[model samples]
Target: MSELKAKLFQDLSDAVVDMDEEKTVETSHRVIDEGIDAYEAIEKGLAHGMDRVGELFDQEEYFIPEVLICSDAMYAGVEVLKPHLKGDEQGEKKKVVIGVIEGDTHDIGKNLVKIMLETSGFDVFDLGRDIPPQQFVDKAKEVGAHIIGLSTLMTTTMDGMREVVRILEETNLREQFKVIVGGGPISQSFADKIGADGYAANAADAVRLARKLVS
Candidate 1:
């Protein structure tokens, strides 16, 4: 039983990193038959793989295409195991509000961040792209999210991130939710200037920085 369980984990990890959709589904069933805990298989095996992929991305060893496919594999495995997840799982996960700030139509980065957060068991409320500053504050308040992830690909749109921070400050909610900033044109200096709680260069770094901020 232990050997089977271990193999199932290895297979699941391979599926995620390799982005093998069929293999991901196949390994999920093998996990059930092998008697491995479903959540363990997901959190430890699948999500862990994605996390590693994220790290590789941070190092530039893997690009967006690799990250995208790996995320797809992670989701495939999650879909198979979703039904087996505990009923109370919904309330146990952390809630996050994510969006691309105003004047930015670049969603690829935002979407990647959402996938990483969701795969890591965050309840992501994606507000999509070109969102106004007030919308971020309102959504965070409504969803009771502890983390607000802002994305922007254009330097011109980076002001939108600062505006979101400004709104949060004006609303007195700046201290309530941790803010993380990311995108192609954003830097650590930019995050510091905008009063953001954290800055990440890539999707993986975003998850790591977010965990640190919220934790």
Candidate 2:
């Protein structure tokens, strides 16, 4: 990369880590004006920044509020770069259907997974919170989604994730999509018991799991 291009990417990463929304937006616009490759800007710039945010989160150097702010800054840059993505880039993206299971209103984890999935090149169909089991199956079928991600933060609602797998099996659609579960109360053992294809303990792992599922 040229010195100027490298600096722009670094500036984009710094803006997200700093949670500077205005600078993020400005840098994104400059990237577009300079005809920088949007995909590279997103991956090498914004996603690079969020990767650090994840590390900070793992070390407890960053909390929920700080991560949320970083996400906001990252998204501001993404909005500017999205429209410029090449047709082939968009065409090659994988599809994911994600939602929080029924009887649970918690969605912070689900939202984080969605954002990370999108940043990692998955086209996510977010069903939001309190989604019924059939909705997940139906949406996955509708979109030809490769993965169905279910999340619940409560023990009571964790059973809802199992129900989703059961419904898909009964419909003979279980083989059509990979089922991945996550949240505060979920685990690999729980995922195996529930017949889910994979489990993610957090947002970054969710992305890796999604990629592995589709791969």
Candidate 3:
């Protein structure tokens, strides 16, 4: 990468972390003006910042309000770059149904996955926080979604992920959709225990996992 490109990407990342929406918007325009790849900016800059925000959140250095504001800044940058995406970036993409499991009000992880997946050409249906396990199945089936993503930051709500898988098995829809699980309290072992197809550690991995599952 060119030095200018690296610097701009860093600025975009910092803008999001700083919760500076105006700065993100300004940097996004500079990205377009300099012909930096929009997708690259979203991935390396905006998403990267969100990754940092997630870490801070895990450490309790940043709370829900801070994360939401950072997301706003990230979205502000994406809004400017979205329109300039190359034609190949536009397509009839796979569908994903995503939400935080029941008893868990934390939705930041789910939100980041939503943003990243949508930017990567997936049609994402965000069901928001504290969604019942059955609701995830219902929405996924309704949308003909190829993947179901379940998230929760609380250990108490982790069982909801297993319940979703169990429901799919009981309804004989287990084969119809790939179920992916992740959150602060979730791990690969937990995902396997719940019969989830995969576990993604972050937004970028979620996008990669979604692509591989659908492909």
Candidate 4:
């Protein structure tokens, strides 16, 4: 990329890392004005910044509030760029219903996954944190979703994931939707035990797993 383009992308990334919503909006407008590809701006700029934010959270350099603000900045940038995206970039996308399991108010991880899924062209229905297991299945059914994404950072709430699976099986909807689980306390064995289709380690991995399950 040209120097000017590179600098603008860097600015977009930095705005998110700094949690500067105004600057993120301004830089995103600059990206559109400068005729840069909106998709690249999202991937290389906003998403890149969120990746850093995720790392910070992992290292405890950034807490829940900071990460949430950072995501707001990134999302502000994304909104500015969304309308400018090419039609082909938004081809038919599989619908996914995602939310944190019951009793867990922590949604930083869920937010990250939503951003990644939305950016990757998946139709994501985010139910926010502290969601009940039945709600996930209900939303998936309501939206004709192909996937149900369950998340929780707490072990106590992990049972909610299994509960969702059980509910789906009881309702005879288990075969209709692929279930994917992830979070700090979730493991491949837990996912297997719950009869979920897959387990993702992070947002990017969730996107990949969603694609593979749908494919």
> Can you give the TM-score per candidate against the true fold?
0.90, 0.92, 0.66, 0.73
Clashes of 4: 0
Q: Kindly provide the TM-score of model 2 when superposed on the true structure, using C-alpha atoms.
A: 0.92
Compose the digit string of candidate 4's lDDT tens values, residues 146-185: 9999998889889899999999999999999999999998
Position 48, candidate 3: lDDT: 85
Q: What are the clashing pairs of model 4?
A: none
Candidate 2's residue-wise lDDT over 98-214, tens digit each?
988753455788888887787677899999888888899999999999999998877988888989999998989889999999988898999999899999998878988898888
In model 4, what is the error at residue 214, expressed in angstroms?
5.7
What is residue 203's positional error in candidate 2, in angstroms?
1.7
lDDT of 3 by residue, 94-115 (tens): 8999998754455667877886
lDDT scores in order: 0.85, 0.89, 0.87, 0.87
Residue pairs in clash, model 2: none
Per candidate, the number of residue pairs that clash is 0, 0, 0, 0
- Judged by TM-score, which candidate is best? 2
Q: Give the TM-score of candidate 4.
A: 0.73
Is candidate 1 or 2 superior in lDDT? 2
Of 2 and 3, the candidate ranking higher by lDDT: 2
Best by lDDT: 2
Candidate 1 has an lDDT of 0.85
